[model samples]
Target: MHGKTSLIEHNGEGVFQGLNNPLTVTRYHSLVIDPPTLPSEFNVTARSASGEIMGIRHREWDLEGVQFHPESILSEQGHQLLANFLKR
Candidate 1:
């Protein structure tokens, strides 16, 4: 789902379920915007199938960002996603 405004762009952000760093998450009408370019060593953990950025994860840092509504009732794994984040 694509939109004009900065937020409420896509419905779901297709993510990569990597072996080492699993981050397969879903969104419900996401409003967050992905950065145009990431700094060196910064890895994009998740993104839309069309290549639209979704989530960014720093390689050496504990910082991370999700360009989706992982806390919304419409989200599939909203609670689980937040729980995983808190565990990390």
Candidate 2:
């Protein structure tokens, strides 16, 4: 990640269901990279403004992951994001 803030667009499925789309989050990473390969069982649930994969979920497995720092106070809806995940 390059900026202090990042835009994350949700796919409105899985763990991200009913939450705000295009969420603005605090990013403080030195390097941004994509996964080499994604398994068929996983679904992309979110992406950055630049089309970088930002979130993924395996509904059947009840698994989810996010690339941004949702725990940071700077994130607009970090608390909500965490809540959603816990509810899953």
Candidate 3:
């Protein structure tokens, strides 16, 4: 996927439950797909709460995304990130 480098947080609610840290991320950009319209309450990581979109979810469609590299070894919660997404 095409993306950019960033850091994100996993708020307790939503798809990122049981995680909260300033994680290094990669925000992907899709040339063919339009990004989902996220709600204001889409919980951003604590460090990014000031101004940053970390994760988003479209519950009706069962789609969600985290702007961080949750699978990367760089993330402390990498394994959890994958588990959370897979579980959902």
- Write the candidate numbers in order of decreasing lDDT: 2, 3, 1
* Candidate 1, 27-66: lDDT as tens digits: 5454644455467776776656556676777778777777
Q: Which scores better on TM-score, 1 or 2?
A: 2
**lDDT (10s digit) by residue, model 2, range 1-88:** 5558888899877656776787888888845545567777877888888888888887588888887888898887788778888887
Q: Which stretches of candidate 2 lie over 4 Å from their true place?
A: 30-36
Residue 74 in model 1: shift from native, Å?
A: 1.2
lDDT of 3 by residue, 1-88 (tens): 4555555555565556777565555545422222254455442333343355556666456667655566665556768778877787
TM-score, predicted candidate 2 vs. hidden true structure: 0.81
Best by lDDT: 2
TM-score of each: 0.60, 0.81, 0.56
Candidate 3, superposed: residue stretches over 4 Å from native: 1-7, 21-50
Give the TM-score ranking, best first: 2, 1, 3
Highest TM-score model number: 2
State how far residue 68 of model 2 sits from its true place (Å): 0.6
